[model samples]
Target: MTFFLQNFFNGIMLGGLYALIAVGYSMVYGILRLINFAHGDVMMMGVYFAYYSAVVFSLNPILSFTVAVLGAAALGFLIDRVAYKPLRKAPRISALITAIGVSFFLENLAVVIFGAIPKSFLDVFKDKSILEKTITVADARIPLLTFLVIIVTFAMFSVLFFVVYKTKIGMAMRAIAADIPTTSLMGVNVDNVIGFTFALGSALAAAGGIMWAMRFPNVHPYMGFVPGLKAFIAAVFGGIGSISGAVLGGILLGMIEIFLAAYFPSVMGYRDAFAFIILITVLLVKPSGLLGKKAIEKV
Candidate 1:
């Protein structure tokens, strides 16, 4: 029972992290109907930003994290303005290709700037207590970082839900998602809203990336690639455009991965493949996803 509880807790922690990144994917897709392949790279950049802030400038961990989130948000906004904005009027295929290009660009840029080596995230941070400490419960020892990650994830999601449902900008976002032309005719600044969407999504991705680095204790140029892809799968699994769905999908995926690896140690190496299998199952069983509504396009 203790072992089961431990795995369950770990699953939740992992799920929350994935949900954080998945929300970014879902948000961008919900608003623009475009899959931002560069979203994960934006997360990688955030980790580097935090890394440099702490190592080079010698800033405290909290300040470094703040800088990371803000820097990634700014990067997201810039990507939209520079790469995606111009393609807004073009076909979606164009934007999709550009997203891929942007992703590659960011990855290579990191390689050029931060080098190809992996850095230890905890070793550089001045404060390691958050991650180094553990709490005992019913014979199960859990990292304090796991609790922190879960709490922060929930808090962030609360703020996100509030911003999306209770605020004016959120209403604008919803309007834009429904019909860009109609929203523009409604006198809303569609471009600003779209840019804000990108910024918001990137911020969440950065937060996820920070937690992810802490949990894994490594930061590399390519670190975000697989997690980013899995988060996209989670987004699609739960219903790509639904915020709640993203959260649900991430949690489920995380749990499945953890449990599968725990029970079938031999298959640990193939754990990553499980995500693709789940993705295929979801697509075949329900193309619209578990929480997604089917769209009825008019001719």
Candidate 2:
């Protein structure tokens, strides 16, 4: 029972990170219907940015995270301007391929620049009171980090919820999501909205990446690979275009992976398999995911 509780806590903490990354996927899909394959690499870039800021600039973790998020937002803006904007009117297949190409380019670029060496971000976890502490409940001990994750997730979502549903930009974003041509006809700046979407998504991905690096402490050029895939799965699992759905899916995925790793020792060796399995299972059982609404075709 204690073991189970421990694993459960671990899963929740992991879920927080997944939720962070997953929201980005859901947001972009909600607005643009594009997967933004490069989203994960954006997170990787955040880690690198934080690393450099910490080591080179001698900044503390908080300042480093701020710089990383800002850098990611800028990078995301550039990606939208260069790779995706021109293909906006083209077949979505073109945009999808471009997204894939962009993803490849960023990953390879990281390799070229940072090399294959994995960087250690041990200092991120040094401060126990901030985001890592231990508490007991019903034979289960939860870490302070778990609580911090819960707090951060709720805070982030609350802000996002308000921004997407209540603000003027939110209305414009939804308008674009429903029909870009119509939204454009209404004199909305579709390009700017798209750029904002990328920036917001990238910012969330950056936060998730830093938190994840803190938890795992080891980051490589390809570190974003699995997290990116899992986050994508989370977005789809809940509902690709649904913000709440993405968060729900991410948390659930985190829990499932944690349990699978704990109870099924053999599966640990092939951790990535769990993501594929869950993705397939969700598709087969409930295609729309837990919080996702079914998309209706107008054709």
Candidate 3:
């Protein structure tokens, strides 16, 4: 039971990260119906931005993390304006290809600038209360970081929930989601609403990237690739375009991967494949996901 608790705790920690990243995927898909392949790269940029802000500028780590998240928010808006906005009227295929192109561009651009080597971000986790403290569960000691992740995630969810359903801006976003043309006709600035959605999603991704790097203690140009893809899979599992679904899916996926690796030591090497396998199962079993609403097409 203690062993199960330990692995479960680890899975929750990982799920927090996955849920944040999955939010970005769900938001973009909900708005544009286009998967921003570059979303993960945006997270990578945030990691580096925070890294340099701490190491080069010698700023406080917390302050650097804030700057990194803000920078990533700005980057999200920039990507939409520069790459996606132009193709707004273009075919969905065009936007998808462009998203892919942007993904590669960010990855290659990072390689040119930051090189292929991974940088250490151990200091980001050092000297922090959350990192230093641990609580004993029977015989197992659980890191405070796990609880920190959960607390932060729920806090973020609250904020996002309010922003999406309560605010006037959120109303506009929902309006756009319902029908962009109708929303535009209602005098809502579709562009601005979309931009804000991107910004919000990107900010969350940045936060996830920072947390991920702090836990993993390394940053590389391609670091966000796997997490991004896995998060995307999580989004799908939870039902793409559904916010709550994304979170639920991410948590379940994380738990599955962690527990699978823990209980099935022989298949540990194939842990990554488990996400896709689950994705396939979900696609076959329940395409709309656990909480997703099935769409009705008028014939």
Candidate 4:
């Protein structure tokens, strides 16, 4: 029971991290019907920004994290403006290929700027002593960071919920998703809404990247690759274009990952495979996703 409880908490924390990234993935897909493959790279950019701010400028973690998120949002907006805006009316394949190209460009650019060596994610928050705290549950001990991650995730999600469901901008986003041309005709600035969507998603990705770096304490040029893909899978698992589904999918994926690692130690090396397997299973069984509505086409 203790083991189960500990793993469960750990899984939830991990899921929260995935949800952060997956939300952004789903948002872009929901709004633009285009997968921003470079979304993960934006996360990587945040990690680097935070790392430099903390290590070089001697800024504390909180401020550094804030700066990182801000920088990532700007980057996302820039990417959309420069790379995607022109391709908006182009073929879907063209936009998809452009996204892939942007991903590669960011990776290589990082290599040129940061070099190939991985940087130690110096624990800037360690001195704050929050992460060092732990609580006992039966025979299990859980780190405070676990709760922190979960809390932060929900708090951010709440902000997002308010923005997505309550505001005029939220309505505009929905309208654009439904029909861009009609929304534009209705006096909504479709391009601005799309840019805001990118910024919002990129900010979430940045937060996820920072939290992930805190967990593992390392950063590299290509660090976002696998996590990005897994988060994408999580988005798919929960039903793409669905805000709630992304969260649900992320938590479920995180739990499954932890359980597999806990119970099947021998298969631990292939732990990453679990997400892909789930993706395939979800695709075969219900491509519309858990909370996703089935699309009905008028022929």
Candidate 5:
């Protein structure tokens, strides 16, 4: 029972992180129907931003995170204006290819700039001792960082829910998602809303990336690739366009991955393949996903 509880807690922590990144994928897909393959690279850039902010600029944690999030948000906005906006009227295939190009561009740019080596994230903190603290609950040792990650994830999601459901800007976002042409006809600044969506999604990805580095204690140029892919799977699994669905999918995927590795140690090496298997199952069984509504195109 103690062992089970430990894994469960770990699963929750991992799930929270995945959900954070998944929300980025879901929001972008919901608004633009574009995959934004560069989303993960944006996250990688965020980690680097925080790393340099702390190590080079000598900023504290609060300032480091602020710079990283804002910088990533700006990057997302710039990507849209530069790469995607021109192809907005072009075939979606063009946009999709462009997203891939942007992803590769960011990855290689990081390699050129940050080098191909991994850095320790914890070493940048002045008081790393606080993060290393642990609490024992029913014979399970849980790190304070785990609790912090979970709490932050919940708080961030709360803010996201409020923005998406309660605010006027959110209403405009929903309107655009429902019918971009009709929303433009209604006098909404469609381009601004879309840009805002990208910024918002990228900001969330940056937050997730920061928390992820904290948990894993490593920062590398390619670190975001696998997690980004997994988050995309989670978005599709839970219903790509639904925020709540992304959360659900992320948590479920995290739990499954943790439990499968825990119980079947021999299959640990093949764990990554399991995500692909799940993706295939979801597509085969329900193309609209668990919570996604079937999109009907008006001919």
Candidate 6:
């Protein structure tokens, strides 16, 4: 029972990070029907930004995190403006290839500057004081960080829900997702909305990247690769284009992966295998996703 609890918490914590990235993917797909493949790399850049700000400029961790998120948002905006915007009316494949190119470009850029060596945050700032001690409830000892991750995940979702459901921008975003042509005809600034979508998604990914760095204690140019894949899977599993579904999928995927890693040592070598399996299973059983609505083709 304790083992189960421990694994469960671990999964939820891991899910928080995945959900953050997944939200970005789903949001972009929802709005533009385009997968921003560069998003994961955007997350990679965020961690680097936080790391550089903290280690070199001696900034506070909170400030460092803030700067990382803002920096990512700005970068996201730039990417959309420079790469995606001009190709809006081009072939879908063209935009997708461009996204892939952007992803590779940012990753190689990081390699050139940060090198291939994996770096850790030098000074522990935020979340550093989380007690190392674990409380044994029954046979299981639960770590403080586990609880903190769960709380943070929930809080983030609550805020996200409010912003999406209650705000005017959120309404506009949803309208655009439902029908871009109609929304544009209705006088909505489709381009600006799309840019904002990228910025918001990238910002969330940045936050997740920093929190993930805290948990894993390592950052590399390619670190985002696996996590990015898992998050994308999670987004699809829950329901691509559905905010609630993304969150749900992320948490569920996290739990499953952590449990497998914890209980199955040998299988842990294939840590991401379960994510792909889940993606396939979800697609076969419910292609629209666990929480996604069936998309109808308009003739």
How close is every model to the real structure, measured as TM-score? 0.96, 0.93, 0.95, 0.95, 0.96, 0.92
Model 3, runs deviating above 4 Å: 125-132
Compared with the true structure, all predictions reach lDDT values of 0.90, 0.86, 0.87, 0.88, 0.89, 0.84
Inter-residue clash pairs, candidate 6: none
Instruction: List model 1 lDDT by residue over 1-299, tens digit each.
Output: 99898898889888888887898899889888999999889999999999899999999888999999999999999999999999888999999999999999999999999999999898656667767788888987888887787787778878888998999999999999888999999999998999999999999899989889998878989998998998999999999988888988999999999999988999999999999999999999997788998978799
RMSD of 2: 2.0
Q: What is the C-alpha RMSD of each candidate to the true structure, in Å?
A: 1.3, 2.0, 1.5, 1.5, 1.3, 2.1
- In the range 1-299, model 3's lDDT, one tens digit per residue, is 99999898889989878987887788778767888888899999999999988888888888999999999999999998999999888999999999899989999999999888888886554465665578998877777777767776777778888998899999998888788898999999999999999899899889888878867777999998999998899999999988888889989999999999999999999999999999999999998877778978789
Say which prediction, candidate 2 or candidate 4, comes out ahead on TM-score. Answer: 4
Cα RMSD, model 5:
1.3
Tens digit of lDDT per residue, candidate 6, span 86-204? 99889999999999999999999999999989997646464465546566677777766666656766666776677677998888888877887889999999899888888888888
Off by over 4 Å in 2: 123-133, 136-139
Worst 10 residues of 6 by lDDT: 122-131
Across residues 1-299, which tens digit of lDDT does each residue of candidate 2 receive? Answer: 88988898888888888888898888888888898888899999999999888877888888999999999999999999999999988999999899989989999999999888888876443454554457888878776767767787777788788889999999998898888989999999999998988988898888889878877778888899889999999898888888888888888988988898899998798877888898998899988888888877679
Model 5 per-residue lDDT tens digits across residues 60-90: 9889999999999999999999999998789
Q: Could you tell me the TM-score of candidate 1?
A: 0.96
Off by over 4 Å in 6: 122-135, 261-266
